[model samples]
Target: MQKRQSKHKGKSALAEKLCPVCQRAFSWRKKWQRDWQNVIYCSKRCAKNKITKEPKPCE
Candidate 1:
């Protein structure tokens, strides 16, 4: 016997993740932050190299 398949296969929109720094929406990914839970930055660079490091007082 032959098998049948549906027209729509493996077609789905990616989940949007918010960035902690910029606070913007971004595309979802796998392997790297696949969990998509408790995400910090939108990009690797942003996450790796954070703007604020030391505790500095505001002028």
Candidate 2:
């Protein structure tokens, strides 16, 4: 009997994205497959920091 072939023969290339807050390169993940387009920050910490670090308008 012949061995079955896999749908993915080799390692799939992981897409990379830059984090807005940390400014670091991050790779794609299975959990973010559906919402990859919406992902901007690398982690929750960065996301939270982004909200607090926003520049305030002069009064």
Candidate 3:
């Protein structure tokens, strides 16, 4: 006999975002739920690199 299926199974269609640094697609995560709008980089590495590439102020 076949087992019963869950109603919520395979329904977790998470949102996706594009990473500016790697130019790749990334999916939404639970930790970012509250600050999804504020999220920019997909990982810490990307965020760190972002700040390093900023233009320097005039001396």
Give all candidates' CA lDDT scores: 0.70, 0.84, 0.81
Among all windows of ten consecutive residues in candidate 3, which has the lowest summed lDDT? Answer: 5-14
Per-residue accuracy of model 2 over 11-51 as CA lDDT, tens digit each: 34678888888889998888999999999999999988885
Better of 1 and 3 by lDDT: 3
TM-score of model 2 vs. true structure: 0.68
Best by lDDT: 2
Q: Give the TM-score of candidate 3.
A: 0.65
Q: CA shift at 2, candidate 1, in angstroms?
A: 12
Q: Highest TM-score, which number? A: 2
- The local lDDT score (0 to 100) that residue 21 gets in candidate 3 is 86
Stretches of candidate 3 off by over 4 Å are 1-12, 51-59
- Expressed as tens digits, the lDDT of each residue in 1-59 for candidate 3 is 99997665342577888888878788888799999998889999998777456688999
Provide the clashing-pair count of each candidate structure. Answer: 0, 0, 0
Each model's TM-score, in the order given? Answer: 0.45, 0.68, 0.65
